[model samples]
Target chain A: MSKGPFKLERAGLLQLLQALKTQGYLTLGPTVREGAIVYDELHRLEDLPIGYTDHQEGGSYRLEQRGDGAMFGYNVGPHSWKRFMHPPILRLFRARQANGDLEFESEGEAAPKYAFIGVRACELQAIRVQDRVFLGGPYQDPHYKARREQVFIVAVNCTQAGHTCFCASVESGPRAQTGFDLALTEVVDGEHSYFVGEVGSEAGARLLDRVAHRAAQEAEWNQALALVDRAARQMRHLDTQGLKERLYQSLEHPRWQVVANRCLSCGNCTQVCPTCFCTSVEDHTDLAGQVAERTRRWDSCFTADFSYLHGGSVRVSTLARYRQWLTHKLASWQDQFGLLGCVGCGRCITWCPVGIDLTEEVAAMNDVQTGRFAPKEAGGAHV
Target chain B: MVSLPSPIVVDPMRPRPFRVARVMRETADVVTLELEAQTGPPLRFQPGQFTMLYVFGVGEVPISISGDPQKPERLVHTIRKVGAVTEALCNLRKGAVVGVRGPFGSHWPLEQARGHDVVMVAGGIGLPPLRPAIYHLLHHRQDYGRVYLLYGARTPRDLLFPEELKRWQYTLSHAPGATPVRVTVDRAEGDWDGAVGLVTSLIAPLTIDPSRTTALMVGPEVMMRFTIAELRKRGIPEENLYLSMERNMKCAVGFCGHCQLGPHFVCRDGPVLAFPQVRDWMTRKEV
Candidate 1:
């Protein structure tokens, strides 16, 4: 509980997980699965992706050995914290018909308290972005709010930046700033391996008290800070100055059509996006017509059905769908939520099949805006 | 600093049961149904707000409230047989039960247009969504300066609430208020004597004070755009004009992100929005 940057040994992390478990929280952290690092249930410290790092680029991701045996060596993977918070599939309610009258029942299962271990800085910002989306709106999503309120975040400072990462560009990452219970900066200095932990909340202090820790030395604290600073410097740059206005004014920009040509409209980017919260509902009924349930699932704007009306889909072309997704992310999101939608985790870039980088797209749009580049004729392609 | 779970007072996604009290066929493809809540209180809504109507086995659709705002006892929805959900809704018999999650989105600026000249333009099936607003204006007729109802449909057969439209025209004609009901059709047939033109044609002929007029419209996006242009040419400010927008909706209460028109979620910030607020968004194609 002292105002000290506490130092915890490698074994201290195992005890920290045990403390969270004793506090009745389901510990979830990164693990190697299906040739990629994904967040899943973590029962032991070994479940952490130790000595493993991810090589992420546009349309590509591969796990690599860090060799230093650092616990939190990688940047984000395809999976975001939203997978656990706002699940891909959830049953909203169920109804049964009795004597020609319908009786509705809410699926009232209690939301589980989650101790999210190894949460990256950008993912923390992503969680905050979703907080405004599901809870800050006029109508709070009961399911989302329930789960989010009980979440105990353990944010990890990124000591290494992936090729796709631009959290520094968006000013959301490389170092955990706020909105976490405990912020950890992993220091793998030569033969010494430990974590410099900063308690962000009373709960964090209490949890740290239960673990083996000591006041971090000035040299150790500086080493951890330097590592995070080095990671920040390695990030790709995205000029956000007038970005909203640029995207809005460039609605007819030929670059959209150019991008749409290569864009598959497969919605891989949306799935990996931490802040994309669009969803659709499905209704199912029993064969006997006695019961019916409505299930909500994550939906992508890339799909034609996402904009369907009585006559037809509003956004018919892949050009329009792609335009909708990007515009909503960079421009309209500010108007809607008073915050930029993209956290610059670069999941959209890493997971896009055609390797479309948004930073590069914005740069192209900037060139057009400045009249420095005149796009060649797109042959009657409409944006 | 451990926070306890908040009590779940209500789940917005859950729909309340409503029984079909009466089904009045308006056209071959459209029908108006009166719904009464089976257990709870009636769904009270403003003139322009809409409800998410759910057919048991089928899907749900966002349908505007067609009943009078003053009379909240019997909820009415004028539905056209378009998709599978609306098809099920249109074919519902009396005593049949359906789920309704409602009274969402912004309403017509009735309070702002109280003393101003009210100009209402409706095209095709859009008339039903505007009926509740017309009722409000008529119920409090003395509060407004001038009231105009300009309606257009594909044909005379396609016009909704034929009997009620006639009654409204007759009653407003004899009253002290300056109320006029102008009807038009795209292509008149079978002894149809109405003006043969688009709804925009009706706006040009109306004598409205530009400063005092508050134009409200509900229809196809193209129709609304044209009507807005006509109204603008008449010197009405963009902010004074209102329109009811339609979009694909899942959660009627802004949880599902389907009903977004630019930054505004049609279910929350709109469904009814001032023209100036959505001018840029409306002009953008496939936004």
Candidate 2:
């Protein structure tokens, strides 16, 4: 419970996990599952992906054994903290017909108190973005607020950068700047692999007191700092200055059509994105017209029905859907939420079936505007 | 720091139970349901604002408040049988319970259009949504300049409130500085004596002063587009013209993204918006 950074060894990681469990938290952390590191319920330290590191780029992700026994080395995966906070689907309420009269009841399941472990800096930013969407607005989502209120974040500072990572460029990652109860910097140097625990809240400081840890040595802090710097250097760059206005101006940009040709409109990019929060609600009824349930499920803009109107679908073409997604992410999001929708976690880039790198696409648009990219000469199409 | 007008603690998604007081058949496919809230004070809403009408064990759909805004006790909704929920709602009998959430979205700026030459245009089922506005204007007859209502339907059979329209025409004829109500049909079938052409054609006979005139239109997108074009040809400022837009809405609040039109959430920002606000987006083939 000291006022400074503490050093927790590889063995001490177990005590931290045990403490979260003892505190009645539904602890969740990264685990190797289905050939990818995904967030799941954590019961033991063995659930952590020890000695595993992930290699990620556009349309690719591979987990490699580092042999260094680093517990948190992966950058990110398809799964995000939204899977816990916003949820893919939630029942808003239940309506039942009783005595020929209908009664509406908010019988949704009680929100679970989650202690999210191994949350990355970019993911922390993503959580903040979702908070704005679901909780910050005037009409707060009661369901999202109930789940988000009791969350205790265990944020991890990145020591390695995935090929698709651009969090450093977005000024959102490489280190947990804020929005975490407890922050950790995993340092794997030479024979030692440990974490520098920085308590961000009184609750985190109290929890640290129960863990087997000592004050972080000057050498250990320096290593953690060096690790973050290395990751930042390795991260890709994205020029986001004036991106909002630039995207708004490029509504008729030809590059949109080119990208549309490659985009499957499969909506995988939206599904994997940590910040995409659009959802659709449906009413389901049991046979004999007895009970009705209103359910809201995650919906993607890529789908034609997302913007369907009485006459027809508003965004009938893939071009319009792609335009809506990218424009909202980089441009109109600022207008809607006062923040860019993207957190540069690279999930969309890594999971795209056609390897459509958003960072590259953005850069290409800028290049076309700046006369650096010749659309006709490069792809046999005119700009 | 743009926030919603009010932060309601009660779940806006949940609807208050309402019972169908009376159901009047407007047309073969359309029914006008008089809904009375089962409990609590009556639901108050502005003209052109809509409510998410939920049929138990069926679904929910956004139907405009077609009744008088002044009378909040009993809500009147004119619903056409289009989809599953609407079909179920159309079949609902008196005493049937329905879930009502809203009146959500921006209302017709009737207050702003006061003292201006008001021209209201509606096509077919679009007439019901504009009925409330017409009622408001009629109630405050001295508050505006010349008022004209141009209504068009597919056929005479499709026309809504024929007796009501005749009554209004009679009342306006007897009133001082009386308003004019015009009726038209796309194709006049058997004994129909109304003008036969597009609804936009009705705009030509009316003396609309572009500088001080305000037009409110509601209908299919194609009809609205042509109406806007006719309004524009008449030299109406885009800001003075308003249109009520319809999109597939799940949650009548901003939370459900189904009602989004470009950057605007039709449920929140508007089901009614000024022509200028949607000018560029309206012409774009697919938004």
Candidate 3:
């Protein structure tokens, strides 16, 4: 009667799609294909990642299958809530010259009510970061502010760890504390599997009432808690306290040189980064060549031209630019936005050509911060 | 006779290829264009902001406000033909059309500098940005403190606003709210009786109450740097000093980081920056 938690049998849960579809719900979840885990238009429950999990680091990425058909078994991905909310590129305004007057037209808003099927804790935090970035900021981005309000989130507890994940280190993860419409913990037994789904919103409670599910018993809740606890214990973690300040002080640290030697400057890390939102503007005239239209494109900090000015670029060297980017994401981000830029996702390390792990980088910096490593003379150190 | 006050509801101005309204070849490289904002609201800009002047295939460049802010009807851009867009803009004839986006970037602190004695120091073609300030000073002389101008051009002919400068000196002198003028040329030809040497050299002769004065400066960053250094030696506070900067600005909005200087966007946060606000970034090349 408390509406505390409910249980759905594993086989019955796979039919969760048919139930949602009949109820006019759009189920969006992860589908693995082409060696990468991507979000796509999913219709059937079969499209979900049942026995798949992924390994991600700075620049290295891999997707693999598990022994079981356990659904919802992956970490944060290249796509985040930003895509549905902000949309990578949106037309802001158009100028029309009419009757010798310029008119600034506000673009039409996107219309979609989304259901994020496999949301994780780190992503929940990432959503809040973007919320603060797009809405909480003084500008109040109209597009992001609107789309975020229409979504219903289904948070899944991570019972498996990814190589690049360290939300446990940053006090962000392993469990969904808040910011979800529904939270689920998948518990598998030898031949019998069930899910403990807790309704976090009235919208979720109303939706669940339509499905056939048993009220979770006290024992079932405890088992769900145990499953979540095990996942937390398995987390590959990182410590985030004062990490910003420590990184800021290490601008010339040899770690940058080591990272640059391996960095291809391919810009994969930022492309997959949930928090990187810088953009560039472009102007194009129609095929008729009568009118010109200006559009904005997503931009990355790794590009040297990104910082170019009248005289020259501020960051002239590759080493300095790389240091600026890494330090900004880990250190200066807090100074600019009052939050840690990293979400503990290991896409940077995993996708990196040379396996330049952020964990190792931070560990080296931590050691250097505490005087554990001998400072090298100029041009004397790299990795 | 008096003029009616200008409309301020301000429609979003549109860019039209004004058949080069009339190009006055000011100097070797600098030329001024008079364009009418087509079917768009009249263009309005402050002393220090800029407009993106676009030539068909040539590209766009940020040119400063070289017209009177009070006269928001017609748009005036004084450009130095240094790059592709500048060359294209210069090549346009009395009727060549082009696109324009702006009156963008933060304007000079005209209202803020109203009651304070204003010292204007400009170098090379940097004088365009200060053109609006000079116009404002001449228009509302009573509202401001004593006005002064220090101008320096690369050569005798490179100087701009020639006709206006002559009147601003002769016709506008002894008129209410007028400022003293000090013009200089780095290298002069015949009939150049103005002060010689750097623009900074002329500052020594002008007496300014640093405490009550605001220095409006525009020019090459180096010229502004040396002039500001000399002013600082005069014990001028950084708060009262200002500089209008330029970069290859593609988008005037804050979205594009092209015109960014450290934490601030030159288009939005400034084309005008107080010395103290940009002191750190100015140490690097971008600023």
Top lDDT prediction, candidate number: 1
Error of 3 at A190 (Å): 5.2
Query: What lDDT does each candidate get?
Result: 0.88, 0.84, 0.70
iRMS per model in Å: 5.7, 8.0, 11.9
Best by DockQ: 1
Model 2 spans > 4 angstroms off: A217-219, A368-383, B1-7, B170-179
Cα lDDT for residue A117, model 1?
Answer: 92
Tell me the tens digit of each residue's lDDT in model 2 across A69-120.
7788788988998989888988999998889787889856788989999999
lDDT of 2 at B179: 44
Q: Which candidate has the highest TM-score of all?
A: 1
- Please state the CAPRI-style docking class of candidate 2: acceptable
Per-residue lDDT tens digits of candidate 3, residues B20-123?
56788888788888887545577777778887776653356778878888877778888887766787787667756667767676777888886777888988
Model 3 / residue A184 / CA error / Å: 2.9
Q: Quote the true-contact fraction of every model.
A: 0.52, 0.48, 0.08
DockQ: which is higher, 1 or 3? 1
Poorest 10 consecutive residues of model 2 chain A by lDDT? A374-383
Flag the better candidate by DockQ, 1 or 2: 1
Model 1, range B118-228, lDDT digits (tens) per residue?
898999889998999989988988888778899999998998988888878855452455348899999889999879998898888887788999999999888888888
Kindly list the per-residue Cα lDDT of model 1 for residues A258-365, writing each as its tens digit: 999999999999999999999999999999989999999999999989989988998989998988899899999999998899999999999998899999988888
Give the clashing pairs for model 1: none
Give TM-scores of chain A for all candidates: 0.95, 0.94, 0.89
Q: For each candidate, give its TM-score against the true structure.
A: 0.96, 0.93, 0.81
